[model samples]
Target chain A: MKLSKEEIAHLAKLARLDLPEEKLEKITKDFGSILEYVGRIQKVDIQGIEPFTMPAKSEGWRPDEAFEVDEATRELILANFPERAGDLLAAPGVFETPKK
Target chain B: MKPLNEITIAEARKLLDEGVATSKELTQACLTQIQSLDGALHAFLEVYADDALAAADQSDQRRTDGNVLSKLDGIPVAIKDNMLLQGKACTAGSKILQGHIAAYNSTAVRKLMEAGAVILGRTNMDEFAMGSSTEHSAYGPTKHPRDPERVPGGSSGGSAVAVAANMCLGALGSDTGGSIRQPASMCGIFGLKPTYGRVSRYGLMAMASSLDQIGPMTKCVEDAAIILDTIQGQDPSDQTTSDTEPFRISKLESRSSNDLKGLKIGLPKQAWQAGGIESRVLENTKAALAELEKAGAEMVEIDLPYADEALAVYYILMPCEVSANLARFDGMRYGLRKQGLPLFETYAQSRAEGFGDEVMRRILLGTFALSSGYIDAYYVCAKKVQALIRQAYERAFNEVDLIVTPTCPATAFRLGEKLNDPLAMYLEDVFTVSVNVAGVPAISMPCQEDGGMPVGLQLIGKWFDEATVLSAAKVLESELAKQ
Candidate 1:
């Protein structure tokens, strides 16, 4: 499938990447070749074959038991926040407020 | 005697046990090598001099008190930056995770620590393990150990360089589409990618969960076996890890038969094609095969009809997983953050600034592939084709005990040679990706040197059969060394 500039931009939006305009053309061209190369998979006659995501035999299943991590481990995880408030990780507000 | 750093793990173990060399001396030798060459090679992102030496001394103390943990006790090794080491910085070579400290040890690293293996440092890699060349690493590309001008193939390039240059005796590298094996081939070292689910992925920064498997890069096959034995096992945290049988090192010890008595090696018709492959690579691989044949192994010509499509399937599936796996880097928890007024913009801006060009391209490619109208054509089709490829390998294995091919089509290219061409970079993994796609174990070892560069011969083993793969690799390793 041919990916247009608009298509690439839409893809960037979907992927949460704000790509620069100058690199757009090059990326579009690069994607064209890559897509063309990867497009070969479309020719495979997968009439009855189920899509295999991963092997069925290698599954490691465990009981659904929840346990609290050690205090030291808990502290280590909390300490990695780029923007933090005491113990919670901070982030931009997700919702817009209604007009008053 | 050889430089202490250049000694193999087996040699170092002997010295340590015989009271000839102390662990401190070996660790110091590695640190000295890193200090001397890593500035030019860029192999290690950070060298843990104090920690490594301290660990070494502790191991020595244990040995003195008759409490050595395992055969790996006091051994110095490196870990690819993607694997966490508890409190150490784990960027996975991406600027996104800069200043990020791992809260807990990765299962592999934890195992290494438990075995008393001294961790030298975290080596550099492709950012988010996206690129074939380590050039995509945010820090800088690691230079080839032998030639500074060429690449040491990647995304495990730095680990390969570290092992190749003797900065570390062995290293842990994660392979998602040949990240470990290709670099090992390029650097002229032994690299193994254990069968999928053979190793736990508890703390490895996920690039493609289904395809990623952590393995060892080392000076010898025995060392690869040692590291794999220590690291491979089912872990409670990783549901994908299976309770596979151990990679019994004892099986590799008995080398009574000089000939591969009943071993059947398959040469796939697609891989042996001369057009895409370099002349020297073809020659060396053919020569290596001839040696195996002379040693009485049956050489069977096998057909893998879907072999050519493995790369296509990998590119599609890998990015789809990458886009999902890397979504956690939204500037909220831990990593580089760029503030924008709206929340959506914040996520976009932070990622856009944090990731490199290739990463962004893959993310977008993944988004497009899995996006509305195109999902059936790209994602589903690739997955179905992946099944076909897997079946082809399964059928081939019925006829042959193992499959063999050149690890890479060509020696490591000059830096920037294929850097600008994304498709060209992907082609370097053409031979190696199929093993990952099939989820089988494979090893790449130095077969011959093309001019000054080392050419790798790869052996593909059946599912959960790393023993045969390593055994074949050992035979090839010794056979090639004869020349």
Candidate 2:
């Protein structure tokens, strides 16, 4: 196998995904074959070839200006928050405090 | 008249202009079809019956005032769940964004409205447009319109089936790899994937950002042309949309020739191998090409050496982009959230419960490819190979005006056929991915039938040159229909 189960687990963590324990073995096998297939790229000699990421030529940058959000649009954005307190969007706290 | 729902956009426009049919009648006819067929087909995630009828009435009023917006005015059409329609749900077939309503219109949606097209509703799709089959949709799998046991090719499966079964006159589907064309081919309709920057991407859920494009799925090539004419233009909201020449339906309409007298269509040597293409699909595709040849188009066999590496390049680059685009789905924002202690745990737990297997698999694969220590071996290598593939197509385009291939190696498979084997599912994209890689336009038209299911013939054209592609497809479409 090209990728071990531990590697797949590590990937899931880095991707911020919480994979269930039962699905790990199957995912590892599936991911391994996909990697094996995509490994064919290594066989091609791309020594001098430049990587082509996008087709559109850069049209220069748009002006970095912020515009005012209409009230309806602002309310709509705030309304979508999963947990909100009035105008403030809420989330679980990071960096837990040690016992005093 | 043959049930108003079964009529094509061209025929409907004629009827509406002659005052023989009202927009409300057309909308109701489509709603009736959705009511009867959608339950079994699972083609629609939501149906805007009342809103559509209301829009239709407004269209009828415009006609009374002699102020029609364009040919598409009052025509009923569906949008893939991935495209936003303001104030309505836009789930993108994923539970992660399940109750999420779009605040503003997708640029395509806005253009369609501006043209007075009645918005029918949102069709289902593979979750976040990840899988080739709509079976990956968190809601449920969309069945093939003809054979309920088989899959309508996806992630635009629902939109394909909608247009195929007449749930709506036409629909919009986004193609990343083969999302739109594969499903359109399977369902026996016209699916167009315009050049990467030809259509604006604003408000559409991003899959592989560089490869994603929203195009039309319709009953005829002209209908595809008409829809493309309406939605093809640069948008201030989307920076990627190019200011290239607009798609002109008049150009498509002006072509009166039934024969492809001067058109040089290239048959890629790499696409026609014994093991690569199924015997039945090859036989059908060749037969269709023979008809085009008989009509006077020259068929040249051209070499595309790097075509074989397209799927690999697509898988790597796509996942990398997918991983980055989907990172926005943290539980802190819109959609579903599963509470947990500490910020990180909440994000992980929410995603675990929200995304389906295929989505998580892609995310994990993408994360691994882009992760440190492996980036060069996978990500950079794939991109370099992608450059080779693009260059090869550019060289071929100099020799041939278009390229022809079987949309898929085989007909639509049973629902669970390739569900478990991820690589097998990825193989379904073999012939279609290269088009996206080269950033060219392509269309899939039904060529023949294999075991009762429709087989599609793909016509590819130069970048930003959809006019030539659609005209050639129109000739072939008319000739094939005569049989």
Candidate 3:
């Protein structure tokens, strides 16, 4: 249940959250209490019980058919992008540019 | 005629059918009430006044043409901001999606629209439905109509308040954990969390996907039944939706007429007492059980031994899902996008700025729980405990047709009281979470008043068996009304 600041930062990294240095102290303290609460799971009797996501069917498999989105709707979704070109969204480059 | 805003959906239908009242009059009355009271209540994030009036007028036109959609036709309703209304802002009460508009109608909202229910507006909620109190809303907290100093328990606080204060006759609310039921309890109205997969989640913003359900918050059990009838069914948009026969309000009434004879309601020995429930709340719950017994229902003492651990299981499993579901808010396509030269920085910075404190805390908790080193101890263990809890309920249902418990351990608490401590706030849902965890339908209805504040009695039924739950609640509701 003891969550050190280092662990909090590591979690922030994994979560893709830009946590500042100051937020770490409070978050770590929170993690301690929250972890303490859920720590009861460790004591739960699970000798033969399976790890279940839901009591009923949690998800369903849909056919991989091409569902259609009209042009107007597609335009609206593209419009929400931070960097937009004509009918397209610009995602930041995943690979570095080659040096000439 | 009675004040337009005071009429229930059934009453409005009767009056409108008799040409005694117009949908415009009812819709206008609600708008006037909102104009007058919403400044103090903060229940609505945005009100669709003009659009609602137009819809109401259209309903009037259709009715004049001798055509009607359903009982909900021409009635004004509110929607939790989390449920999408296409072209309306679906904030989920967070800055993360400050200007994000819903591209298409959520299945529930679309159903309501098709039913000719004039959606008044989007009500406030906890940011991404994270907190127990509406105080976590980035927009602002929704005040209790009964006591301005107290919170209208949330994240469906606005919808509850909307119905309580007559801003809308009924509203749709989504429950993940106890969001809908607890708020309904606080507001002294009827709220139902249908069995998971009973209602489609096509457009309702995801909280904990496995545990979440869209349901109705209304002034009466019958209205809850009517709304549920309209919105519950299979949909191609959501695969989890079942072909369970849609719940029938008439069947519920007919069942209630059987007068509760031989009906068994159970009280779990291991639920709702561990943290010392308030004396008044416990007394009200016991009194309600006795009242049901007086009306010919058999009340039995039962045990959901694993329910004592439901909270721990919920906190673990829910956040793990949250960590995964909320990971989509990375400033890439929609919602709050911040710029850093690289894509990674944009995601982190956007989320860091967009999410509120409670949301961040949960995301962190979820991330930590799902982390490789901690997964077995936290997430996996919680899931096993969840299965155990479900099994306990299954066994209990085999013995009893329904279960009864306090909707909340206490009435509505003051707004700022538990904000400082996260765990204290999470405990507000102790009584209601297990029902969601079990994937069963449960409802909260006002059983009594404690010092002028409402105490809610929760009726839980077998998975997908909302009829028994509503019927049993109707028996208790009429009993309370008679008194």
Candidate 4:
């Protein structure tokens, strides 16, 4: 698969990374090699097999109560953050929130 | 008094039973060892000196009171930093959660505690268990005890090093891909990756949920079995854990024999393929097999039809799962947070600054694989290959009782040898990845020396059949001892 520098940058953006321009060239080359290495998996003939995500019968083994983080624990967790104001964490605004 | 650092858990338990040594003295000896060696090895991320001593005292009290917890009661065991121990910082070797203490204990940790194992400390690991070397840890790389300039094999490198250096009697490590075995091989210790779901993954910081399994890193197979016996069981917290019959270590140990008679060992045709592998590694592996044959095990050639593609499939599946599992580490919840501007920017800035290069690479690759247009093409294809890999193991098992291969392609390389080349680093796990992908149990045992470095023999077994693997390892251990 041919991936351009712009596409790599877009992927980086989606993944929330800030790759420097110099590193981008190396990353591009590395990704090309990795993709090339994994290219062989595309040829395996698994047409009739259902795509396995979770193990078989995994759904039946789900816990009775959904594991939940309680408010106090959540508050304690958030309190350890280096940058939080009130009940919310603070960050630099990049993309604006979309209107409902 | 014999030094506690030199004694294995089996020996220590015998001492404790015969009144030769008290748990308190044994625990104190381990603490001293950690004090002496940990400064250089950095094997431990945090040492619970006070708590460990106190636990040892409690176990002694239990003995006097006639209410001992179990055989492992008061035995000091180190835990990988990724496993949760309530009130201890479970950093997962990442700076983002450096100060964040776990709210709960992992099932494995909880079980160990219940069995009276003293929590010695949390060991170092690759940041979020992402690297082949512990160099990716925010704190620093754990140096191998044998050669300080070289890496201690990683992600679980710290645990292996601790066991190898005698800083801990036994340690816990999670293997997603060869994390435990690779480091154990390099460090010359026994490491096991239990069958997927054999041990619960309740509170282990998820790297690749489907692939991650908690297991033991110990000085020998018996200690590995003892630790495994305590930790392996069903847990309500982790649904993937099986409710199959509980694994009994005593039964496994008793069933083990030095005689490999009637055991058919299969050697994957791909394992001996030409190129890149050092000739010394091939020679040492062949010698180990020859010794096994002398012990009466039959060797058979079997094809792991999909073995060649395991590394590729592993990279795809691991990164994809890791990306999803690690998405929870956003700054808003519990980890590092960068202040300023807006919330979205906070997450972006925090993760961008917090994560190391290897982690960032995986997140990017995983995100790409799971992206809308590429899911079916990459992620789906990898999972299919995973099934094929598992089927290959099933087919091999029908032909032979066990499979043997080189634990790693080569012995421990110098620290910087593969640091620049990610693909080269990935290939280091070539022989070990298939066992993990197939969800079969495997153990890495030091077989011979290659250029002053340890070469490991990997014994792979059918799913959930760790006894067969450990028994074979015990036979090899005895053989190596003779040499």
By descending DockQ, how would the candidates be arranged? 2, 1, 3, 4
**Rank by TM-score (best first):** 2, 1, 3, 4
Query: B14-125 in candidate 2: lDDT tens per residue?
Result: 9999999999999999999999999999999999998999999999999999999999999999999999888888999999998888888899999999999999999999
Candidate 1 ranges beyond 4 A from true positions: A55-65, A96-100, B255-257, B449-451
Off by over 4 Å in 4: A57-100, B448-451
Candidate 3, residue B414: lDDT: 94
lDDT of 4 by residue, B252-330 (tens): 6675467889899999888877467787778888999999998889999888787768888999999998888888878
Ranking by lDDT: 2, 1, 3, 4
Which residue runs of candidate 2 sit more than 4 Å off their true CA positions?
A: A55-58, A97-100, B274-276, B449-451
Off by over 4 Å in 3: A53-61, A95-100, B256-258, B272-275, B449-451
B75-170 in candidate 1: lDDT tens per residue? 999999999988788999999988888998999999999999999999999998887779999999999988899999999999999999999999
Alpha-carbon shift of residue B161 in model 4 (angstroms):
0.7
True contacts kept of 3: 0.74
**Alpha-carbon DockQ of candidate 4:** 0.40
Cα shift from native, residue B218, model 1 (Å): 0.5
- Per-model DockQ: 0.59, 0.60, 0.56, 0.40
lDDT for every model? 0.90, 0.91, 0.88, 0.85
Candidate 2 vs. true structure, TM-score: 0.98
- How large is the C-alpha RMSD of every model relative to the true structure? 1.9, 1.7, 2.1, 2.9
- In candidate 4, position B255 carries an lDDT of 50
